[model samples]
Target: MLDLTKLAQQMQGISQQLTLEATATRQRLDRAQLLMAQANERQADLVQMQELWRDRLNFTAAMPLESLDTRIEIAAPPAAHTVIATDGSQIAPSHHEIAYCYLINVGRIILHYGQSKLPLLDSLPEVFYRPEDLYVSRQWGIRTEEWMGYQRTALEAQILAELAQALTDEMEAPTLALTDGSLIYWFLEQLPAEARDRILAPILAAWDQLRAISVPLVGYISASRSGEALNFLRLQSCPYLAPDCMTHCSEVVDRAPCQVLDPLKDAALWAIRLEPGQRSPLWKSSARIQEFYGDHAIHFCYVNVGSEIARVEVPAWVAADEDMLQSALSLVLGQVQKGYGYPVALAEAHNQAVVRGGDRARFFALLEQQMIKAGLRNVGTSYKETRKRGSIA
Candidate 1:
């Protein structure tokens, strides 16, 4: 067992160290602001720099669509609009489980405000026990876990598309469709070109549907650690007249002049400057994968949502159109206000998707019962798993 009592004396020192770090962080943000002010007029130079380094460098930097300080006023959300959201959970197939089975539960939520439409909330649970479901290529022993996350993302987006199409005649159109994380499909980048194409087909199709419907699909990331904005500031701070990180700063990674802002996140740049309900300028993502997005290219902006800074991403079409961007952001602000620092639809969806510990045990028990009913002799757990549940003193 671990005891906290032994470290009582060091607690104050830890607090003091944290305070010092906070002070240092504030100084770093101040430095970045100075760089932003100086770089505002050098937007052309910045863009040129990014294009020059496009394929050679593997860094995430924000590409501003306008002047660095440009911002849009968030209009009031429609008093009567619908918000739909999705979240997913999974029970991974395990060696210790009673069967080689896993579960995917997707939660869907739709809420209509300023209208009497009853909310639609449901969790769709799917069980995968078949050889086809358990493995992508069983001969190579590539289990589902190796690729389930991307599959779930595609599934969630596809469901959102279904919800949008299904509700068109039944109710007023959704003002926004939301999910709780990055929409970039960065996970697929790790796969081979052919594999990525096969896995990404569904997600792209879902995005195409949303694009056709023009219902702004948003990916809301609360307390984001992305350094796109910070990376931009880093480029501005690059000491070379013609900056080339490889040619100049490659040997001096730690001692580079731009490393001053390296410790800070992107949100810190807007935390103090942007008022609640205000947002940072839209910046197109530099991800290589977005090159393939075609109609669904990604752009993001940071919003000051009262309690915390949130990174909000939308498709290129929505981001470029002023009216759609305004509509989506205003509703996002409303959702944050209603939920108190988070989106209400997403919160409800998460509540539906989360699987409890008791649920896990009961799930396995049910699996065992069903296996016995089917006369399956292979439904057995390892001795180690049994010991984990009923440990000895």
Candidate 2:
């Protein structure tokens, strides 16, 4: 149990830190705007600087497209449009469990507004216990959660692709598809080359399906903490010609010129750059994982949908097309308005996919029952697990 008294003692310090940060952020926002203007005027220079720095640039920064300060009012959504979203939940495998297995459930939601068809809400659950399924990651002793997360992400994309492609072919009006988080598979960068390839295969295939069908696919993140745009803006104000952190910052203790914008994130910065129902210009992500993504490299923009700024990401294919990009943001804004600041379809997809504590308990109980029915003994059942459960208060 958490010690309330200890937590309460630190609460005051936390509050003080927040106050100091907020004050500093206000100061930085002023400078950030000035630097943004300077940077916008030199987009070509900044792009060149990125190329010159290339592999040496320590920070992951975004590339400005045309203008950094460009803001477009929310597109008037089509009268009849469809928005579909998919979210995934997983039960990671554990040795402490009765069954050493994992589960992935993808929740699919399709909401039709100003159309005759009723909403579609369903979930697809899959279990993995086979040796091939359990050890797909190729890591000897790494934690299972990371591999499970990738599997769930792939499943969500595949299911969303099937739904979106069918709807795009069938419907006359525009159709949009959304996944809960980013399209950038940044996590895969940490894995071995073979493992990364194995995991990314299905995800790229799913993206190809939607791309072939010309269905706009989006990755939605609410109150995103992505520092891509903020990091890019910081480059404009760097004191050094090259902004080489490794060589130049060896003697500097603190970020004298750049730390002024330390507290700002993409969402917070875009909030100042945009008004309600407006979106900032698109920017391409510079994550190293993009090297592997190739044509599906991720691009993103910030949208102020009344309550807060939300980050919306898309594949390179969708981002390059003006009509498709506008249709996506407009429908996203409409969904946010309907849900009162969040996407309604994504919200419902989460509700259908979430695996709670009680559900986890029942799942293990069912596993134990099935093992007993199969006339097999759970010989390696965890002793510490039972001890923890039966401990006297």
TM-score of each: 0.94, 0.93
**Structure candidate 1, residue pairs in collision:** none
| TM-score (C-alpha) between model 1 and the true structure | 0.94
**Best-matching candidate per lDDT:** 2
lDDT against the true structure, each candidate? 0.83, 0.84
lDDT tens digits, residue span 228-303, model 1? 8778777788777756767777787456777778778988888877888888888888887886788788899999
Clashes of 2: 0
Candidate 2: pairs in clash: none
| Per-candidate RMSD, Å | 1.9, 2.1
